[model samples]
Target: MSLLQKIQDLEDVLKKEQLTVDDLVAAISSEIACNSYLVSAEGKILSYSLAGSNSDKNADLALKLEFKQRVGFVFQTVANLPLEANFLENDNSFAPNTHMAIVPIHHLTSTAGHLLLTKKAQQFSEEELILAEASSLIAGIYLYEKANENNSDSQHNNIEMVLESLSFSEIKAIHSVFTELNGLEGFLVASKIADRIGISRSVIVNAMRKLESAGIVNSRSLGIKGTYIKIKNSSFLEALKLKVR
Candidate 1:
């Protein structure tokens, strides 16, 4: 199919009511003939669609971890990554044969996230790179609209009462970890955060309890999946003086 036709198809997909990032990833994956992922600027995997056959569960998990790590590295080090598509050679021992391309998804002048494409033993062509860049622009617009729709006045005031209940260290711990978390739909293991930040799990647990009691956050224990937490109020992060990336 011609690139213009493929992009037109994507535009048709976007016209549907309640279109989602997963839907976008699936459409882009079909056009590019590779696994595609939409990752948040904070390194959270927003959505993904795999091409061809699916990998086993273990390999799939490894791939997600690798993507998160790579995105985090890009956010930390590549402050001025261009809007055009760029390639990253996979040095991961678990998936050494993988070839990856990334395009920054921008919200106006600032980057909001990334569009990632990966396939084994196949390098992306120049045409594919252009298509990916176009896809990123569409994804950015969708995300910006969603963000505006989700904004609430209650979110700005929800943390005022909770602030007095938290200690300095507790606030610091919560800011350090929770800022990385994707709201509601995205969950991370609490122990994993503790391990990564070199803090005791008890500190995280206590902070969560206080926040939950104040109705500022909600959490559910997922057994082996650890804790799934969603911030009810983003103002808490701002109140704690969390640094914006």
Candidate 2:
């Protein structure tokens, strides 16, 4: 199969597995031919993928980022760092660590989390960025789906609980709008969300807009057919498992 097709196949697996951030990090590291992959969520290691067999990874790498720095600045560096940027761009890089990429994940308006991909500096190529970004996109979809599922179960759940680092309001008032809602009948309209929420048409419209932006639901105009919203992804328990892994 073509490279793009292989990538797409990986995407399908990611979607099917409800691939967590950790899964994608492994996929990225393996695909990029990198030695190891380390991912931080809010600075703490969310996942790690070692390139070759290593008895002790921690004892081997001398260079590392501060716990706090890894979460914020180091990751920010990955996102903003330009093409071909090396060692200076991310302290996570040292000799034998040639390639690296940082990505920022955001759903709706707020930042969801970050992803980092590293290869030996000498080993990285532009294609790695493509691979990394593609993985990030898939990861974003996975997280977005998880966030929407969380919303269904919790009254105050607004954020997707990425990395356990994010903080937000209960969205209690906002959620009340949908409290009375029941599976949209067939598919709920803006009016239903607005009426149940006891808000103005504009407010309901705005809420749906935000929810759609977060990929919690999908909205489509039937044109002459009808306009409706479809719930995005179900709960983690209900999500499909792509493979045995």
Question: Model-by-model lDDT, in order?
Answer: 0.70, 0.50
Best candidate according to TM-score: 1
Q: For model 1, which pairs clash?
A: none
In model 1, which regions exceed 4 Å deviation?
Answer: 54-95, 152-245
Give all candidate RMSDs, comma-separated. 17.3, 13.1
Off by over 4 Å in 2: 18-21, 35-41, 52-97, 121-123, 156-245
| Residues 116-146, model 1: lDDT tens digits | 7786666788777777877887888889888
TM-score of each: 0.51, 0.47
lDDT (0-100) at residue 155 of candidate 1?
52
lDDT of 2 at 100: 54
